[model samples]
Target: MTPSSALKAESPSALETISRNPRIRIRRSGPPAEDAKCVVYWMQRAERAVDNPALDVAIDVANELDLPIVVFFSAISNFPSANLRHYVFLNQGLRDIEADLAERGISFIVRRPPKNSLEALLTELRAAMVIGDENPCREPERWRSVLAHRLKIPYWTVDADVLVPSGLFPKHYFALHIFRPKLYAHFPTYLVKPENPKPVRQWQRPPNFESFDVKEDLTEGWKHLDRTVQPVDYLTGGTHAALKRLKDFVANDLAHYQDRRNHPEKAGTSHLSPYLHFGHIGPLTIALAVDQALKQKVITKEAYDAFIGEVIGWRELAVNFVKYVPAYDSIDCAEPWAQKTLREHARDKRDPVYTLEQLEKAETYDELWNASQMQMVKFGWMHNYMRMYWAKKILEWSQSPAIAFENAVYLNDRYELDGRDPNGYAGIAWAIAGVHDRPWFDRPIFGTIRYMSAASTGKKFNSKLYIRNVMENEPPPLLT
Candidate 1:
């Protein structure tokens, strides 16, 4: 039979393989007859066994090769620029992931790295083929590139985070308007129903390795590591909680999402950004659920489209931006006009210079800004709409644009569970540096990044009520 004919004749039930780079390959390797041909070195994303493209592809490849699949997660002592808050959230998520994998008949191995990158751990695992969830961010991408080069075996990077693969589009997107049409056109192709994992009848014993409890090791191991950052205690992490949150949102809040999402006090939003950022829930699952809701006529197309725009259009654009522009995290990725404008406005005078400590402690003069900061500090997440106003205030209050950008990133990464995401970086850049944003009415420090003010927020919604509710009810350190 011809290769094309064989391909056509194959069962339609087979798992679909999606690759960004055509040169990437997945092959059977390592010990013979052991039934562990494809070993997935799971990194970046966590939790759900369902709706995960990487885990699904790995399982399918293992089944085809008649081998069992083993999933490995490497925990390094020191992640570059990561603070105590980042570790706390990630560790909590991982703890939940370990339990979930065990229930699914998959072996979960946690290997401790000597340092941040998993170079030493991957080398020690001798994995036949390492598979990781694609992340356009600096650390994960750097780690993947190092692994692909250093590992003797083949490596696969799967786009499980975004609805559309980052590689499907060109390296950088011009703007949200430009990227929106492209995402809408490809939604059908990437929004297929998620494949469920068929339970494996035979279990493959994992090779003996050192067990590193993320919580205990993180606390104990901090002293031994090169870095001196503290561990955070923000929001609870892990797949179980993420799934629970999704179910809760759908049952309790999704109906009111259209009306109350913009209000900070209502808890009407999904609050899934952190989970999405960490890969606890796949974008496909969210899309499917939202699509189903739309079909049921539970949500208006306008509302559904708005939500989808965020997940697909805006989110994917950020991923695409980072993927193409290597210096996306830096100021160089900003448009030339924006760069010049920001530079000119960098030294502009401020109403009051708020130190990083003041911002971090939510001690700003604006009660609304303080409330938002408190939310980020205590809950580790913020409403999407308010996040813009929150970030813009930081730009206005700091001594300079550069200092404002630095403080904004520091606060977000330290407090928000969804911090360290491409979206987070893009949001900060958009607020401070005007990356991907068009020029608007001139402002002091922002210099045409589009200004958002407390008055504007109040005009859009019941600002007084929202502020009162958050300040009174959202719990302390924040309420204080």
Candidate 2:
């Protein structure tokens, strides 16, 4: 069946994008068998079964072939640069996905690939066709490319994580101004309702594999890390938790989102970044809920539009930028003019240099910076506006631009539930290297990149109130 015809046959939802390839590619090594009858769905990025475009597409192809669909999840014992906090959050999400798939009669198997050995497991699975979630990050992309070459059968990647497929954009954008119009053009088609997964008539289960115990692994793993640092206790990780948070945000917080989003004291911003980063809850689900609220007149048009602008516009904008620019994580990817200015001011003396260790401990002199760090330490997440200030302060306080970038990325990835995401990388790049930002007033260390300071935050909002709130509610960090 033609891809277009297949899409038309399904629900007329704008949430899904169809694959044009006749046969999905498999990256495992083997000669193609004419009657090889299995479609293996990659379950790494898009963890949730529902509101997932890749899973939907894989199911469609499997149904057409009259073959059983098997879901594959590879949990490497040690993902590069991942700390205890990162592991705990991801493992929790995986546990939830496993249960969700079991209820749908889809077999789920997780294999702990030895450190740096994903290919070995792919060879063992010998999947006829492989469908993977598309991500622009280094590790996922590297794995995808290696699998594509080794596997003889057709392999395909679906853009399930973003509102618009990353392939739609050509290059990294300078800022929101450049990417907003492009996203707005595609918003109507991307924001359509999603089709529910059709139940399988006959269940065919794969061999049972032991599910990894997230809590146990986390407890054992914490002993290996420095005993001084603590884990974040902001929100529990999982698809179920993510869905509940989204529902609560829509029902209560979204109406006040426009007004209190910038206020660090208010629970106005939807604390769904970590869940979205892990793909526990997809952007489509969030978009659909917001759209419904707008139609029901629960949120004003202005509020709804504001929310959509972030979910579809800015979020996809970052995804598209990373997709097109392979070196987006590097400082060289910044505009030539910005790079020149930054280089010229590379050695400008910082007022008070803070080592990565000091920053991690929330020991900085600035009370506001300390408060934001405490939030990350205690809650595993920081407010959206504070995140901007928090990152910018890292640039201002560190010994060098590169060191500052490394420190910010490491601390965020280690502590925040939403760290190590494409958005996380992009946010860091924007904060330190000016990836999507334009040059502003020249300053030491920052050069021409826009500068943010606690003073500016104080001028904008009640800084004392923000600090007081965090101190009052701060939870003890996760124990080592």
Model 2 ranges off by over 4 Å: 1-18, 21-33, 114-126, 199-203, 206-231, 473-480
Clashing pairs in 2: 24-154, 25-154, 25-155, 26-153, 26-154, 27-151, 28-151, 231-478
Q: Number of the top candidate by TM-score?
A: 2
TM-score of 1: 0.84
The 10-residue segment of model 1 with minimum total lDDT is 23-32
> Lowest summed lDDT over 10 consecutive residues: which window, candidate 2?
22-31
Predicted candidate 1 versus true structure: per-residue lDDT over 128-154, tens digit per residue: 456667777778767777665666554
Q: Model 2, residue 332: what's the lDDT?
A: 56
lDDT of 2 by residue, 1-480 (tens): 334443444322331233553222223322223474566787778888778888877777566555567777777555556666766777787778778877777766665534223444345555455677877778888878877777666566677888776666767777788788886787787778877575453345445544444444643543454433355556778899888988888998898778877777656778888889889999989998998999999999889978888877778877876777676666655677777887898888887999988998888889898998888877778877888899999988887777788888888877777777778778888888887778889877888988887777877777788798778875422111
Candidate 2 positional error at 189, Å:
1.9
Residue-pair clashes per prediction, in order, are 6, 8
Model 1 lDDT on a 0 to 1 scale: 0.68
